[model samples]
Target: MNERATLITNEIVEAIRGVLRKNNVTFGEYRAGFMHLVKTQQAGEIPLLTDVFFNSTIVDIENESRKGTRADLQGPYFVPDAPVITDGQIAVEDEHKDKPVMVLRGKVTDLEGNPVAGAEIDIWHSTPDGRYSGIEKHGNMDKKFYRGRVMTSEDGSYEARSITPVPYQIPNKGPTGHLLENIMGGHSWRPAHVHYWVKAPGLRDVINQAYFEGDEWIGNDSCNGGLDEMVIPEVIENGERIMEVDFKLEPAVAKSLQAAE
Candidate 1:
């Protein structure tokens, strides 16, 4: 390249880093990309997308309050067809046999306050004894245990039969656990929560965990940063437990290939 062109390129690269430093956009890979774009002043060529693009997109609206201040992701431990149940019913065999039998019901809606009819809600959780079924400590029990799925109706509503979840220690044998213990000095316990992965046509998929209200670990949800807005309350009705929570998903992006598919 010519000397002048090389000089211009260097100047542009420095300019990008300067802008990124000024904005304090610190997060390693993202910081580097943003700096490069800013330096070239042709950021459009780099394809800019927000975090919301990759994760679940949430909406703010009436009755759209976040549940569980201690919300965290449900993790990767659930199986399918866990048995669809009705109100005031228990599906999993709780070893405690004394834990509360909870009835959970709620609706899945979009950002515009419209019901996302026919959405699929996959729900799962640890057993009443605070152990997930099928683990080494727990035998493979075909008791229709603490996992299940339900579909939202025309009104975007769903109901499931389960028990109140209890806080348990996160798996400390995995990479995430190693990072917590070695690098972050963090423990491996998460507040009790129910996993919900909601999906429907034209709606962004939401894989989130709704936490119990007033739990001691609410402030320490592993996801971090977004609390005070994800916890939901449990209501006891005539000897049955009921927890209601709703999910607001973002609309399908207009140009998204998934939308076309």
Candidate 2:
């Protein structure tokens, strides 16, 4: 086996064994947990389940050594290469007309706060009812509601428009949801948020999710994804909820994308 894999695997195994010993876990309970894993795999929700439990921890570790905006989970519903949106209206369908309009404005910058021009911001988010455009069960594959791509301008600024997504339970009818509620005693509700995958040449891309201020699950998201720095206060005007949150990227291939900020 690979030395690093063996070392890490040994620690993980020992830690799990220690938990079992500490709890005096019975074989029956262990079997049940195994079966739960089987069902989660069968449901094709292993990533979803793991994200709910551990993706945040992984992201925290990644952010610890970086000087850029914190990264968040890239949830299961992302559809790539969405059409380039120009009018700033990401929420396309008429169904979104009555919801709380969310105007997202931001800048893509480097650690030194210099602009990253021509950066592609691939963004996807749920409707006000929490259904993503391409998710089959949620439906709307025929329409690209609340999903699009935007590019940073010469000033390294980008903007998008969508509705404020409400807190919605993940696919909780499955084993993952059941385990969370019955075993962990927690609701499976994510907060109102928007996802932005910021990409530019020579820089490490940032997977960002912007959360609304005063969301019911601000600090208590089921996925535990968004960090305090990612939250934006809401400013309502003429029935639209406007939010501004900038994203800073870390250098990957070099220290500078451009000399100008």
Candidate 3:
């Protein structure tokens, strides 16, 4: 080994020797390699560590087209139990904005493209003013008016009424955004996206954000790798903007019944 490698190896050996000298327990010489493996595994990359320990590919994140998943960390702007309306209906707060209201509707299907009935859909986003609640204080903005959830029917269809999401800057106060803003030099802004957490009995929990097309910042989204399929084009009908996007999930081979058991 080179001088540096030899020094590192000696240091590792000395550390292991120190541990052996201090411990009450006895370890066989054959187990020394196992200790090295454990140390190396712990110091390995994040994906390898997660896969080795969790047995789930939690880090094998991929987008709709099997590309790397981008990190889009939206803060606490979500509300629970909003109303469930029908297709083609406007889904937004009573108060209006210069940007038009958009109707988002779609069916939740499994790998085979069959509708996955009873899938839970939760959607939330920041207001047009680019500030999310729980962060804004002493404001008259409608509370919980733009966020909600619904379950897919037998046909796996769900809909939510939300205003057209506006591209917003990441809060520089948060650790993640702060680090990005300081290091990346002015490209920490996320594209316009409505965040959704979709869950079904036989499928994995899907936490995704659907972005809007033609957004100036879509190319620079700090998350989701700026996938094109996740970007829905603004559809206009009779002078109003609309957005429709569908989600396809992989079916779970053995649906977890841990709750019942």
By lDDT, who's the top model here? 2
> Which digits, one per residue and each the tens of the lDDT, describe model 1 over residues 1-261?
578789979997999789878888769957665565464343332121222121222222211433311223435466665666544254656455677777678888887778888888877778766777645545776636677668888998888777778887655554445445655797666688878778789766766677777787787744342345557775678897667878787764456654443
If both were scored by lDDT, which would come out higher, candidate 2 or candidate 3? Answer: 2
As a TM-score, model 3 comes out at 0.60
Supply candidate 3's per-residue lDDT for 239: 70
Query: How far off is residue 179 in model 2, in Å?
Result: 0.6
Query: What ranking of all candidate models by lDDT puts the best one first?
Result: 2, 1, 3
Cand. 2 TM to true fold = 0.92
What are the Cα lDDT values of the candidates? 0.64, 0.83, 0.60
lDDT of 2 by residue, 42-147 (tens): 9998988888888889888877767888788888888876888888777557766777777888788999999999999988877767788877788656446778
Evaluated at residue 55, the lDDT of candidate 3 is: 26
Measured with C-alpha atoms, the lDDT of residue 76 in candidate 1 is: 44
Off by over 4 Å in 1: 1-74, 84-90, 94-97, 134-138, 173-185, 222-226, 254-261
Model 3: number of clashes? 3
| Each model's backbone clash number | 11, 0, 3
Query: In model 1, how large is the Cα lDDT of residue 88?
Result: 29
Please provide TM-scores, in order, for all candidate models, with all chains considered together.
0.61, 0.92, 0.60
